[model samples]
Target: MKKSTLLIILLFITIYTYAQRDQTNQEPGSTAFWENLSKLCGKSFEGEMLNASEKDQFYGKKLVMHVRTCEDGKITIPFHVGDDHSRTWVLTMEEGGMIKLKHDHRHEDGSEDRITQYGGTSSNSGMSKIQFFPADQETTDLIPYAATNVWWITLDETSFTYNLRRINNDTAINVKFDLTKEVETPPTPWGWED
Candidate 1:
């Protein structure tokens, strides 16, 4: 009995040592955030509208967000509302270690929508749990009305949030997804196969 107990203790010590080493070896800066987000791939979560504009009727129904694709330097998440699956949020690690967020909107015919691929890059090396993106010049050129838009995303043990606020206007949208609840994955977003 004593021999068995000693073997078990040794095994736990080995596991703990490796776990500590892995934590210490994690990449610095936003890499931690990227890694955290990547861990959610292949999972879907239900979300609630914290605050939305009156015209934002599209999000007033059952909402689900799935971490669909995750790659070396990019992750694409699909947001589905009711029967609409036209929106996907793409996060990419840009040059100089910055992060960029883009909205990929598409139609049912596998074509891009008129207001697609407009977002911004992170202005700082944000914490592993949160990041803020301000409108870029390209976004301003593409959507003149959203020249002063800012988007923020946050993730923690309990929930994840996607928030948007316009500096020029009083527009604000916040959607919170419960991380503890794993829901059924929704259908593919528009323009995506399978």
Candidate 2:
């Protein structure tokens, strides 16, 4: 019993140490990454209500994504889940534009089933286009096919917003967001039952 316990503990330590090293060795977040994500920082923007298709989802229940940035050059996007008034968020730019957007879902025993992921890519648009790549399989599934949630974020001093939608069949059924116009919107993310 003692040997087994020691082995497990040592394994956890090794894993933790590796994760730390991996994070520290990552590149810094691109200026474009911050500039793009910062567009929605102060505004209390809301999206339109929508729904999910056969394999699609909107996560409606009144979830709110609050954008903010700390002094340490880190970005915080807090997503408020309406069902239990719980909150999770996407913390970015720590080791480059690596993002970890967590969910409020949980297993039967109260163990949160939230997902952590990485996103963002090389500054390819003269600070205009930043690729939000999926770091893993789970994150990829969340993407809406070729019409995935990958955004082509356009940023400027006047406004900051993103459009996360794609064509489903012959129609753009899951139009996730279209608020880059710098205008106030409905109380939910667009592209679902409203």
Candidate 3:
């Protein structure tokens, strides 16, 4: 074969190999779920507590969640409860078809809270519309009481729900948002601008 033709063939082979490697590294279902959630980027939605108790801190407050930032491998969502802008959920894509969920809590001055960056990674290749994250070691170490907390999110065409349940216990929280209606985007979450 001509030297130039040989070089061109080798280049094509290298490109094809790299493409296949990337595809095999990601879990298809997780990737689809991530992309679906990413579609809501820059939009804000209003939500309500599905199981509210009088003792619940967020029971009577106006709840909002803004899918504020979306990037190649990460998505940042700031959750607002009435006047508080202290909670942000950070979802990051990981190797081997896994996704990590971390709670980024900040103060008004954009400083990290003492209890922050606590969450877990997906244990399996969940469905395209849902994923589950069991509390990681960091969460258990930071808050021993929440060692059994399992957080899961479900996204569909019309609604999105964030849920938490402690294994072998009765503690659970569920918040459902209406995706059919877009709400005014809230201000930035604490400590994010910096």
Candidate 4:
């Protein structure tokens, strides 16, 4: 084979290899999961605490969640428990296809709370229906007792569940919402712009 032809073939092979690697690193599973969740934007659902205890603060409250905002690489969900609209769940797609979950908490005056923005990034490429976020360093720094916390979310055609578990402990919270039913969207969460 001619030297020029050989060089051309080598370059083509290198480009193809790099392209494949880049695509693979994009984490198709995570992307699919994001897309699936984004489809629920602007919808609202009523939720119930699955493992509620008498001492659980959220017990017997009217729990609602709104998939209020969906933007490129980001989704914002506001969780309302009775009259408390201080919590919003933000899912951001990070570089290399990871997803970061952050809880934005605010007071009635729309001011940031002291224990806010604590969550973690997905440790691996989770399935299209679920993803797990272990406590990130920032979370541990802000809330030392939550260092062992792991939060996972699952979404399907009929339901969506948000769960938290503390490794090596019995502390857990599981809230499941019925996707089959659409509820009225709640008001803007605290600290969120209209």
TM-score of each: 0.83, 0.41, 0.85, 0.86
Give the lDDT of residue 145 in candidate 3: 86
Error of 3 at 33 (Å): 0.3
Look at candidate 3 and tell me the lDDT of residue 7.
Answer: 100
- Candidate 1: stretches off by over 4 Å: 1-27, 52-55
Compose the digit string of candidate 2's lDDT tens values, residues 1-194. 99999999999999999999996775444555566566666554444434545543444444345563443555554443443423334444444344433333433344544443323332331233333432344656553254243433333554334334442434333223334533332232211112
Clash pairs of candidate 3?
A: 110-191
Model 4 lDDT at residue 30: 88
Better of 1 and 3 by TM-score: 3
Best by lDDT: 4
State the C-alpha lDDT per candidate.
Answer: 0.90, 0.44, 0.92, 0.94
Worst 10 residues of 4 by lDDT: 23-32
Which of candidates 1 and 2 is the stronger one according to lDDT?
Answer: 1
| lDDT of candidate 1 over 1-194, digit per residue (tens) | 99999999999999999999997787656777888899999999999988665578755699899999998899999999899899999999987668999999999887999888999999876779898899999899999988889999999888889999999677688899999999999988989976
Off by over 4 Å in 2: 1-29, 39-43, 49-63, 69-71, 84-87, 94-111, 114-126, 137-194
| Candidate order (lDDT) | 4, 3, 1, 2
- Backbone clashes in candidate 2 total 11
